[model samples]
Target: MDLLPLEVAKKVRRDSTLVKYTDGQFIQSRGDSKPGISIVRSGAANAGIIGMDGSVSMTTLLGPGQSFGEFTIFTELPRTHDVTAVGETEIYQMTATRFTRLYDNEPQLSRALLKTALMRSHILLEMLDAIRRLPIRERAARILQSMSHTAGNPNKLECRQSELAYTLGVSRISLNRGLKQLAELKLIELGYGEIRIPRPALLSDWVANHCNPAPLAS
Candidate 1:
């Protein structure tokens, strides 16, 4: 979902607590039922399901301008997925009590939350359709893109092969082949527990041409 507007973001900064997390730290776990939300102010985090088979199926990669724990806050339910930092990260936490206060004080906050929730819902449908239809290579590429941030030089993705394979619901062997191809195509560089995307746009262009049903009007 989109972030709060600049003025709104600045105002909420006072009501929230900024917390740091090291890579692999859990920001939200299945054990916690606390009503709170975490906005990624700096780095990114992964939110996913741990399957009964001990595999992880990634549901979301929340980067800067994104959030987690909204479902838990509204429903007052136990966290349904695991949220782990992608790297050293900072998040702004809003507790249910604090948010309720904000909702009562600033009506705009509720509007922002409602807008973000609606947008996320629509995006989820589009994502499911794309994931089901795209080739495995395209799917992996998409996930890699999300983790990259895409601000300036592409960053190295800090994830192991097994983890990537598990989250993507593909065999390690298949994932390896995709990584190898990405490397050969100069789209990414594979390292131990990392994949670096040097030219992020190359990956985007490949997906657009290979996976996109309609050609871009350029």
Candidate 2:
């Protein structure tokens, strides 16, 4: 993915600075009245709604170079979900009014925002489909496939097991168990803060066969 351009930074009316967050910090919250857009400069954050039982069902994980909360620019509605930093993070932020003007004037910026939103929808559909049709084994395999696609590499990804568990809405121990099963099946190898999928096609087949055959359109 391309760096969110420095030129785009010029378009933002708010003075840009690095905002720091500790682990489990809520950068944005559900029902928040404020309207602002944030671009991730480093580290990780998740955006999603809270369930009836107060569990967070993450819609998407934002890593370096990703942005979120742009929908606030188009409407006065409160923030749709909480954005919490998973670890120490740095983000550049701007108010919704300025972001709206930028979106109207900059075609590339608009395209970038739309692309991120679409990708988030796709990931959410995959997660929901896994819950509906996949067993634990297939869920693990499919998660690997989806992450590989998002990372654009089966060989390299900067991820942590805790982050993966949060992204999947599962416990870390559960994720570890599922991952071990995949490793025994020769589907993937887990390393410190990363996973390597030697056989992405095979894993995709496992996902296609076991998970719901089609993703729901958003």
Candidate 3:
């Protein structure tokens, strides 16, 4: 992450609270956030909405510097997504009252939150567009490419393929098949609970080849 001015960072830091989460623990559940936003300081989290049928559809992973609960604070509504720690995770929490004070006194901090929300929206929209236009294989490739950036190690991403499948809204079988194909191509190395892209350039080429515009044939 790029450096922010000390004052701006300090303001967010002042209201921040820390919490350590164990595996399978909920950092923030759907309908849980009364107010305020939380940031991931360390470790990782899964963010998704729970379906009426009792299904949990993971939308994405939240890593360091990413914040959530903005919707609840902005709209004064219940939390929309359930955030859970995948492993032992640490987070910086802040209350809405505290956030309000900062926003009231410091317009810069307020604009920062707005900017963050807009960035998240753009990422969500891009994911939706890619999934809509491309096959699951290409989508999976792109997902892995994304993970590689956030992933702590190139050899092992903490998320399992099953969990990744849920996040991508693809069947486990399909994801497994795609992973196998990718492994066979030597583009990535797959594991029981992790993934590694040995050659990101190869995966990028795959996405470009599969998704780029092409001429119509007679």
Candidate 4:
């Protein structure tokens, strides 16, 4: 639903070890078998894969208060993707045993995790639907809208054009073209490494108008 409940978060922090990383350092790797959950304490991380050709395919950005690796703890599986520090970053890491103990003692913790998993699934479904039915501009608009809504500041999104392009499964040139169109329409303003939505509602409205329509009568 929302970010992890404050009480549960406190408990997580209590049991976790504080870990720090510098810019571009890996917090976790794709095949690591360590079972633990990590919460962003400060700064940010990018969850993605670096291709053999050295291209990055970013899946999502994790800001402070976001927790990852829950599935890894539960399934005792290796990490699915690499999570790297965007800048200097701090993370709270709880081992599987400690997390399980906290989980057993806290009903709210379990519920919150379940909600987080469901929300992730819902977003994935929305992304797939958008990819199948929407154009690049509308897809960009929809994604930016979602990111801004989730961010602490609803009008600002901390993302790079390359990361956004990778998330959309588009080339940087194509994404730049779509983004420029949105800028021309005054829906967003692109900065060196961020996007500014002057009015988030306008972006949402534009996406709805362009991406959704009433079905024809049979």
Best by TM-score: 4
Model 1, runs deviating above 4 Å: 51-54, 107-115, 118-123, 146-154, 214-218
Report the Cα RMSD per candidate.
3.8, 5.1, 3.3, 2.2
Q: Sorted by lDDT, highest first, which candidate order results? A: 4, 3, 1, 2
- Once model 3 is optimally superposed onto the true structure by TM-score, how far is the C-alpha of residue 116 displaced, in angstroms? 2.5
User: Per-residue lDDT tens digits of candidate 1, residues 1-218?
Assistant: 24456676776777889999998898887768788887888877777776778777766567676777777767878888888888888899988888777768776777878877786676565456556887777777766765554212256666678877876677999989988877888888998867888778888787667765776789
Ranking by TM-score: 4, 3, 1, 2
Candidate 4 residue lDDT tens string, 1-218 = 14567877777888999999998999998999989889888888878888888777777777777788998878878889988987788999889999999999989888888887897787677777777778899888877876664444567776789878887899999999999999999999999888899988888888878877568999
Candidate 2 C-alpha lDDT tens digits along 1-218 = 26346676565525455689987798988898787788777777766666677665555556766677777766778887878875688788877666667677777786677777787788778777876677666776777677666443455454667756766767889989998998898878889867788878877776676665667789
Please report how far candidate 3 places residue 71 from its true position, in Å: 1.9
lDDT (0-100) at residue 213 of candidate 3?
A: 54
TM-score of each: 0.79, 0.71, 0.82, 0.89
| Range of the 10 consecutive residues with the lowest summed lDDT in candidate 2 | 150-159
lDDT of each: 0.74, 0.71, 0.74, 0.83
How high is the lDDT of residue 159 in model 4? 75
Residue 14's lDDT within candidate 1 is 79
TM-score of 2: 0.71
TM-score of 1: 0.79
